[model samples]
Target: MIERFRAGVLAAALTLLLTGCSAVMVPVSPADSSGLGRETVRVGIAYDSAGRGDKSFNDAAAAGIDRAKQELLIEASEAKTQAETDEARAEALRGLAAGGSNPVIAVGFLYATAVGTVAEEFPGTLFAIIDDDSVTADNVVSLLFSEEQGSYLVGVAAALATRKDRVAFVGGVDVALIHKFEAGYVAGVHSVDPGIRVDVRYLTRPPDFGGFSAPAKGKAAAARLIAGGADVVYAAAGGSGSGVFQAVAAGRKAWAIGVDSDQYATADEAVRSRILTSMLKRVDNGVFQEIQAFVKGDRAGGKKRYDLKVDGVGYATSNQQLGPYQSGMEKARYRILSGAVRVPVS
Candidate 1:
């Protein structure tokens, strides 16, 4: 009977290893001989509501997890969100932790409450949350970014790239978090020339995270802004930002800015020509760094901040047409890092 039970355990472990880590189950593999050969570190990641293919925030986090998988040779598990509610989010975290996936990184601020609730149940598990710093747990580390700083750099680029001296901003949700993007963008545009115009709009309000996924709403908003004579539009609206890219492509002389990831490389070939630049948030680096630290027996806890000075956040230069503005963006970077300019969160 004991031998039958042992065989069952091995069979279950084999099944999980064969199925891959995209789902909730943990991967079972032989331990790495690098240091602790008896145990392999298992890291799990809970992605945001938009899931892994958003080509923005969630994908960036996944990049970090992939890096850890390759370099650390650690076992990994993943859970993608469906409903953005607190209960669903917490349930996802619970699934990963209960499956023996430690150092679970929840990819967005939406996971704060869920992570906090689930972390209490699994005190032995290490938790990391990105874009949220409010969770106060001894085992949880809040990964934050200086998004406003990066937004400011892109704002400067937009100001320089715009031929009409009029730009626009489109946000997915009307939340304080998205407002940070709006505020920094406006400040950056005004920094270049106070007379320049920045038209702004939000697709939806709080509790309606559908805004982030609704590309039609983004297209309508960008279309209206373009009709109003704004030549450059910046979108921080997750997947919905794809619509903004489409709108820019449709507009003959218009430019669109991407957020979270380097949309230039990630965007479709048809729209790549119009993407002026992207705000590089480096979510992947944060995720990988924390997991790497955990694997080294140095578990990272408390707040982990990524800012411009640390290369945690900045603007992309994938398009060569942005050559003229490169010098100015660098100067702006120097000013922000040297305390000559202070970018606001709101």
Candidate 2:
């Protein structure tokens, strides 16, 4: 039952979530980008405190691990988060190591401290940390993204789709990571419409929001904006964004833009058709490539940053049904990428 619940969260399904499910992850494959060398590797992934239910960042990371499982012949496991602790991360890594996994990968910057100390303690085990990298061992691989580029594109999408010149942005926590996304989106909005106004708000002021699992707050923040006459909202907040969709659904006239994976499918039937689009960070690609690289003796060393120019991030306008203004979004997306237009990255 616990496994079922975790799967439901990772699937980002608002409904059909079976009660009492535990977290379970099966990593993906390396078969897509050419043939895999003959080796069966096992990998472990850790989630932020929000767990997978928040359905944005953690889910995106899981997707990458899923890709590794499908393409690479490997065993995959997951560590459910209880808090931000090196002990929890180290324990997860230890489990992966015990299974003979050569290189265990940790998702999110929260895993940095865990990866840093654990990597040193287990010098034989290779490690990969996504989003933020450490100054530790040569055995670790860091995966970062060019979020500014994607944010710029999505910012344009928000500006184009916004009914009022007033748009808004909501983030999980007001940390540097969220700030990066905020900065990029703000730049994008300003580039298209200088006078465009965006009310920036974070679920928590700083350092924390333990219930990163709360979608209610997302709805509340979005509702305030909707009431304030803002017609478009971009939320980089995780599980809380489930509420953003609810707020968008209520507003009817407004639309919610999603992040990480395409969020169109993540919404309810009534509002899903209304989602402007999603800004994608191909984290799954990063995780999958890391596995392939390790297997083929080509793992990237030091800090690796993925950007729009490198195809690491982009916008997904394609969906079950393209939204009301798909073409405009596409044009803006290309313009930003090709340098024909510049979106602010903050």
Best by TM-score: 1
Instruction: Give one digit per residue, the lDDT tens place, for model 2 in 113-155.
Output: 8788777777777888888865457778899988878887778
lDDT scores in order: 0.88, 0.75
Off by over 4 Å in 2: 1-39, 319-328, 339-344
lDDT of 2 at 224: 95
Mind giving the per-residue lDDT tens digits that candidate 1 earns over 1-346? 9999999999977865764443332222356433332356888899877788999989999999888888777778999876778999998999999998988989888888998899899998889999888889888998888889999999999898888989999998998888889899998888898889999999999778788899999999999999899999999999999999998899968999999999999999999999999999999889888887786565557998899878899888889988999898899999999999999999
**Backbone N/Cα/C clashes per model:** 0, 25
Which structure among the candidates has the greatest lDDT? 1
Q: Stretches of candidate 1 above 4 Å error? A: 1-37
Provide the TM-score for each candidate, comma-separated.
Answer: 0.88, 0.82
